[model samples]
Target: MSSHLQAHAAELAHGFSLCELAEGLGHLDMDGADDVLIMGICDDSRHAKPGYAMLCLPRAEGRASEFAESARELGATAIISVGIPVDTQLPSLHLDSMGQAGTLLRRMFKTEQAGAHLYGITGTDGKTSVTWMLREALSRYQQQPVWSTGTLGLMRSSDDIRDIGNTTPSLLTMHAMLAEACREHVHSVVSEISSHGIAQSRIAGLDFRTAIWTSMGHDHLQDHGGYGPYLAIKAGFVCDCGSHGGNVIANADHADIRERAPASSRWYGHGLSRDDVDMGWEQELPGMLRLRSRGEEVVIEDIPLGDFHAENVACVALILMVSQDIGLQELPELLSGITAPPGRMQDVLAGYGQVFIDYAHTPEALERCLRAARKLARNRLIVAFGCGGERDREKRPQMGEIAVEFADAVWITSDNPRGELPAVIASEIEFGMQKPYRAEVHLQLDRDKAIGEAVAALAEGDILVIAGKGHEAYMEVCGRRMPWSDAEAAEKYLRRKNSGTGLVSEGEDICA
Candidate 1:
């Protein structure tokens, strides 16, 4: 791997002092940074900077501490962040677009055309799965991908998984990643285009040939300000990528994206109806699916569990379909290769029946996931879900309604209640239950307890779905995050129960 790292190293690894870095980007010729004395930058802004010393700190890890440390490590004269107050004077430059730094770094590292190919997948819910799926597919051809999730930060698919900080990575880091890929002569980069990344314009300038929309869901209302704005932010990926753009795989099932696809792009994919598709497909199993189009038949025996993943497979198949250089026929054999994403519809056995852990935090995704799970369930469908703190509140009641509508029992619990009261977020979601629920609904402020209780309550044929915090390894509470894995917790409880310790039931587990 040191060999791979050396092979993919970015020239931008060479750092500069504050003045030199500033001089390198001074007096830009572009829209966002021309003659604009950088005051600082928003994490989301990703406009062009012909010449301007832009401070590039965005991703959660790119906060003050990391930026100062990186800048210092790189021998930068000065670093900037929001933590610097107006009252406290420092050698500072502020810009509206921190993403510009990504562009500038791209240029410095020549990441724009890293010999290593790059690919991106975006949608509200299935970004991670598609990325993983494609990474697994591409690997059969001996290509290792640098992957990232819309929720978690960046990483590569090598044996020594390297964490790249942000989901898409800082421009410098992304450039570095691609540079590394280029050095390795790898074929692709499978990444997710998050709305936050889009809103902030972080991935604005990348050249993507293959783009997939697994499914659409509402989210980031607080960041994008509203539904319309949020949609626009998400549409940026397909809409904005220039001529280097290749085939776009869209979900024919999503109304928001049915006709609203990226402007002037090739289309492919299957759906419930083939009215507007080039490839047709459908769900075959909770984590498996099949797609058939144009003498091509791809059967994914054990794909991944999620209402929208089949559509994601269609999109992925479409990408392979269009990539004449790639073999689309191999999909069937490779279909069964990948496993479940860590938290996205993952199976956990804690108490009675099967426990499903998913990262479905949004109303649309949660409802669909539960409804889908109910179909596979022979007995009770138990849902353990909650919304994140300081996120869009409007979806709460809607999520509540979906929970009540699908699951036989509902347990409303905390999910990343970052700085917000768990009760407050829970109450909003509870209000959305349209009718009185026939199933049981419990409220346990502690997430682990909720999982334990839900697990305990599951019968032989029962299914428990823990939504929100998908693929996330930790749980956030009161501004602090401790180690927490929904799958692990459920599995622990189930193992204990299976080991003759006990059966999980409502209020039975002391943890619950």
Candidate 2:
């Protein structure tokens, strides 16, 4: 697919540019006179001058050997980084990091394409859900080419969804993705914007036609440390957006959200508190909700169910309302007609209870998903969760606390504890639990068994939450990523349990 797209893209320098601020560095370099122009700038692409080659790195596409090969394929020029890498052999100028470099590219590349719009959702929690809901809602309007980019990757179930790397693609990659979307005749794109994406300047120059702010909860504390810095970085995206002045959807119930947003810009808030709102909803169930907005009230008889999803529903609905492009009331009827995103809060009916899948690796995300499971559970809530290796370890215990709060029995299973001892990682997570825990915490580093046990333990009324790894289908161990998926494991376990076929693997499934 990339090859086809590459063919259409104009030939440029084989070397990649460093910063948007460095765009046309070729023009200044006498040595680069013969170099193919690969414009690497620390600015917006819209502002980017014409060049032979351009680079958007530190993106979802990731810096890989293939990416390096792609760079080398260009005519000729320079090689660079967000900052300088040690023992590198290319003309390079160091900056802070790749994220910043991507941001500079976003600033330089001005996507002036007509009718092509982008929606970015950023928050510790609700990012994946919001991104999906928006894409689904917008797709109702056939005229709106609603392409979605999330944990599932860019594109949807039927579409060619490929990996870009980070949950949120880098600014340059985003611009390039938008460029591709434009070339492919898309009208709009929905992207999940994580705090890491924002902090690293990945979304730098890209202009979001509309931005959705899902509820903020404690996440990335190790990277963000305190809530203040985290909130500030996440909110900065909406506040400083672009010159076009896009809509900002926020949750008024959150003090940090309202406080973090710029006081000057017009804002819309939605929640249980409905004195005044662009849109509001009353939770009927986890997935089902009743929505009221613009003098119209509609009962969302069925959607996906989860305690945290109601806010996500309102987010997508409000954006639909503001866009005025689709019949907002018509959404409830579509699910019987449409499909669901792969992992975000997916349910599996098997084992001891109902097993669920979500891409919540952060503390806040775990809390939100668990709370949703609690709300939806007719009985006890059992969570199978784990922390990723080499990530912010601060949230591990907090995640344990969330499970301890909602689940009658919580299984500490490895999500993607890459390179780290699964037991050590689980231990840190145990710190957050309070006394006389509601749930019996068990460490099962083997994710498949963690899921199988959680499911097997359930007895009708229990709710099983498989968090951390959502749409993701692999697990990283000792620096090697292996084929692992929570959803698949849940499905396989349930499939086996329902058929009474495969015996549950004990220690084989869980970490020691």
Candidate 3:
């Protein structure tokens, strides 16, 4: 990161004065220098910096006030307390809700995007792919700098790209990115909205011009506490978009999604024709997808990706049609060359088989990846996957069942077993299958070794799908994120095997 990029990063890390923040909060008891600059907003004291204002919240360790004292010791200049006035040397502002205060900070800094069209995509899956398509389409057709942030991090039309490490970043980071985008004179902005982001008020006050709900499925059950709350969080994004007078697009294939999404939302799906559905896609040729909407049809030719991605393309097309006024005639050409983000159904060549790296951690996502691989596999489909630790534990078994049902041979392995024993997570996954499938399941806690064994097992015409931790470069185990990459591991293993050198490449656990 250069100094210029650092400044932009700082822009995402916003700063505001105590007085301005208090004004935004409306009913806050403020005692201290109103002019003291709050140059940073942080929830964790560890991230606190000089002139930063720490928001005291209830953490597992202690209450907000307990952290406030430590933040002051760390050079934090101010504290925004929720219902508790910490006795710190620095000034403290009391508010009823810290989440509300987070929203206010964004508003006070005026980070709301201006002078461009803002688009949002929310769903369990396909958010990154749909947002990427929209970014590429908008940039190509409009011929302006288009910016996008989400699973792929920040994508500017220029060569520079930065990953913010979260699908939906903190409110401060989102605001800062929007502010920076506005400064760069970007013409279009697309963001992937997560259910957690919506429920946590991270995207509060963002006024989108258009929004899309790709599809609904089970995910993040632990974060939302239950499935109902999880669904509500996703619907909240749609409601917010509608409230802001933005056009909402949703997948009509799922009846629940269509019913829960904003009533005025346009829909896209397969084999559907109705006034409500604005677009639909079907297989018109052997290797192409045909999109039909408004009595017009466009054939997307030679799409090299999976069948599951056609829905993502249709969703993006509908969003563009509504937001950018791109017709079917020109839209197909614009979308012809769009590519999937790294690790989302990404295809790489193995020694005698094909390998796919995908971030499909959930059951539905895993199923989709396996289905896609099956369509392309000539002989058999081999899958290497594992459930993430510290997430919704219930999904672990479901994902295990899905992998075995779709893949001929299954390798159950470790996927970022953060703070949990890898063997424990693998055992829970193995618990999901019956005798037939369970008999075929192979457990290798080492992900690299699992991938290596999977490739070695693949026949000439077989396809290998490596799920969970797609583009991520680190494997977190016991609170440590060590450098690891599935794609790099696959490439190295194949190259080594091709050279008749050895199955094990340079470096220990390169693929494991």
Taken over the whole model, the C-alpha lDDT of each candidate is: 0.63, 0.64, 0.76
Candidate 2: regions farther than 4 A off? 1-27, 31-75, 78-110, 242-244, 264-273, 325-340, 349-353, 505-512
Query: Which of candidates 2 and 3 reaches a greater lDDT?
Result: 3
**lDDT (C-alpha) at residue 87 in model 2:** 23
Give lDDT: candidate 3, residue 343: 86
TM-score of each: 0.80, 0.79, 0.87
lDDT of 2 at 405: 77
- CA shift of 119, model 2, Å: 1.3
lDDT of 3 by residue, 1-512 (tens): 20122221132245567777777564544465667887766767777778877766433124566677778888888877665546666777777664566566556556543776788889988898888878887888888779988876787853667766577886667776777777788878999999877876667666777888887888889989888888888888887788778899999987678779988888888864555578988864434778889888888875546777777777878888888788788877888867677788877662343888998988888888788788888888888888888989998888877876888788888999998888899878877776555325677778898888777776788888899999888999888999999999887776666676656322222111
Segments of candidate 3 deviating more than 4 angstroms: 1-21, 28-63, 66-78, 82-85, 89-91, 98-103, 272-276, 284-287, 350-353, 438-440, 501-512
Where does candidate 1 stray beyond 4 Å?
1-103, 142-152, 242-245, 266-275, 284-288, 295-298, 324-328, 349-353, 503-512
lDDT of 2 by residue, 1-512 (tens): 21111111322213343343465322122243344445433222223234433343444234433433344444223433444232223334444555455444433443454367778788777777777767776666554557877666776434556776677765556666776676677887888988888787666556687777777777676787677788888878878763357777776667788778655433345454565566677776544777776667777756666656766776676677665555656757643222346677776552343778877777767777777777767888888888877787777777778787767787887766767888898788877777666667777777777788777776777778787777776787887888876777787877777787764655432222
Error of 2 at 44 (Å): 19
Q: State the weakest 10-residue window (summed lDDT) of model 2.
A: 1-10
Q: Which candidate, 1 or 3, has the higher TM-score?
A: 3
Best by lDDT: 3
